[model samples]
Target: MALMQSKSKILIAGGGIAGLATALTLHRLGLKSITVLEQANSLRLTGACLTIWDNGWRALDAMGVGDTLRREHTQLQRIDTLSTTSGLTKCIDLQHHEMRLVQRKKLLVALAQALPSNTIRFGLKISAIHQRQDRSSIVTLEDGTQISPKVIIGCDGVNSTVAKWLGFGPPNLAGRSVFQGLGNFPQGHHFQPKTLEIWGNGITAAFGPCNETDVFWYLSRKSLSSDAEISYNSTILQEKARHLAEDLGNKEMVEVIKRSTPNSLSLTSMKYRYLWPFIAGKAQKGNVTVVGDAMHPMTPELGQGGALALEDSVTLGKCLAEVDLEKPAEIEAALKKYVEHRKGRAFEIGVQSSVSGILQSGSWWLPKLIRDKVVFNRLSPKMLHHTGYDCGPLQILS
Candidate 1:
């Protein structure tokens, strides 16, 4: 079978946050020829929830979907941390910055709803891509169909085939792994609208409410066991997470973990690309470019993964809007400008998130001392500084 629309002006790989956001941004700019290719049969909502900060909301506002999402969850006003060893507690006020914990499915649905119908083609996997003599790229699908597009954006995520084809190195493991899931309270849990974190030896745990009835949580540990060792069973993983919380003496979190279903549970090691690729290599080749985790994959310490991807959409949208896609040279130039503007910022955030992962997941005395004594006292302010970034507006050139 052949694809009815064999060609597109703009093609985006991956229908997750990055791909959808890029498509929505272009739609907001009045571009009608954008197409998003998702490898999954339906939307991939594996990650149960996401923490969208102020910067992410700004990008959402630019795409005209911020207010719609804001109506679903309350704004988190503070972050509370507990050190298990010293039994010391710290609180950071977030009265100035906006933060919310939202269901991942809802976010994906919202982005998809805002776009034109058929803009996303599900289950179309790209097997290979090569540049044509005319500067366009020819993408070969898994079933042997080929589609040529004037512009190609790789938003396929950390294991991006597009990134590998562009000559980027593999992602590096951060010597730690994480378990994430969502817990439902049918009777309505009454927890305050604040993020709570527990810091234990080589382990960090956090949780917050997604709405009145559901809560999201995660556990990160320095020691990693192979998936086979952990049994690859959600029930077992959920039990393991509950056990870790029990060891940390968080009875509430243990209950939360027990209430979560197997479908919501996930476990994976943290991975990030070294800064050298961004410093020396090209994120944009010919009329092609990469966005979000496809370009820079960072640990979840800073909670900026989703936010940064949103920022990329707005930034890339602005760059592409300034040029005529019909001209291959113009498209290439626009992509280059987008890469120049984003590489430095993404690299800086990736490095900072790595540093934060070390501080939060370290078991040694030195890291614990610094974290409890110095870092906690000013954690929120420093976070505010990083999340305060503005990716500008989405506008097109005449």
Candidate 2:
């Protein structure tokens, strides 16, 4: 049987954080004929956890889910950074803002639940995209079904097919990878409500309580050039993580790694694609655009990947709300503004994250000395505060 023909005012690809948040924000702005297509059979609960800072909380509050998330997450009071080489620890105050550690699954659930039933369609994958002269998109699904929506927003992640079709290239490897896991303590564990990071030769480890009984942790190291074959086996990855934790000399982190099951461990190579070249080289074509990892996939050093996705969703919704969808010129102009604003912000964050990963993973004596002696002590708080931007509420553009 052939798939039935359908149309929507807005089609959002990838029902992850960015897509779901976009749908919610648009609905709040009185635009409800939105459909989100997710390739996965169901919502993905795969990731370990996320560190949502003040900016993310502001976005969530604008979407009306801030209180809901606040009740579920463990609010962090401060961030503690340790240097194994110098045996020094530095604490940066969060100023009582909303810096939270939440399970990825919970965050996804909250975003999904806020939307109306039937807002998202699962197991539908887009294979190709064609933009019309009138600033709309004709999308071809993997099963050969076609959809023509007035607007197409790609939230499909780092390897987004929509982004590829829109002329943006694939994400670049940052020459580093991470192994992450969650440790569950049913009887509860004795750990302060803070985010802890430890850096040493060639490796970095971080852990924090996600809730009363669970702690999220990750270990990152430089990939062996670009030629080394990295193993993805669960047991081997777990073993590698255990050894890295041991090298960090943090008893709490080591114990957390040991307590985690092999199944909870996962490895991912970091990759990013800067947005400036796409904007400068080619004018954004038609009404097709991307958000979140699809647009700007950055290193996790700054923990702004997810937060930025939330920011994108709200901003995109506001921009689109300002125009009359019936007028192609107005719609095009609104999208241009959105792209101009997001591209600048994403590029800055991407560069900052890349540099931070390099400095944190530096093994050289001079770089390590500067990072430990000056950067961590004098500049850490300033860097952290820079991410505290408030994404304002969605509004009608005058």
lDDT on C-alpha atoms for all candidate structures: 0.87, 0.82
Model 2, which residues run further than 4 Å from truth?
A: 1-5, 224-232, 261-264, 278-283, 395-398
| 131-230: candidate 1 lDDT, tens digit per residue | 8787778888898888888889999999988988888899988988899999989999878999899989999999988888888999999756565467
Question: What digit string (tens of lDDT, one per residue) describes model 2 on residues 1-398?
Answer: 03223547788999988889888988877885789999999998776887898899888888888899888778888888888888888888777577888778888899899888888899998899987766677889998888877778889999988788878888899888888888889899999889898888878889998888889999898876432343457666777788888877778888898777555677888898876665573325678888899888999998999999999888888899889877778777877888887887888888889888888988888779888888877855666765778779765221
Q: How far is candidate 1 from the true structure (C-alpha RMSD, Å)?
A: 1.9
Please tell me which predicted candidate would have the highest TM-score against the true structure: 1
Summed over model 1, clashes come to 0
Candidate 1: where is the Cα deviation over 4 Å? 1-6, 228-231, 396-398
C-alpha lDDT (0 to 100) for residue 77 of candidate 1: 82
Error of 2 at 219 (Å): 0.7
Pairs clashing in candidate 1? none
Instruction: For each of the candidates, give the backbone clash count.
Output: 0, 0
Q: What is the lDDT of candidate 2?
A: 0.82
Against the hidden reference, what TM-scores do the models get? Answer: 0.96, 0.93
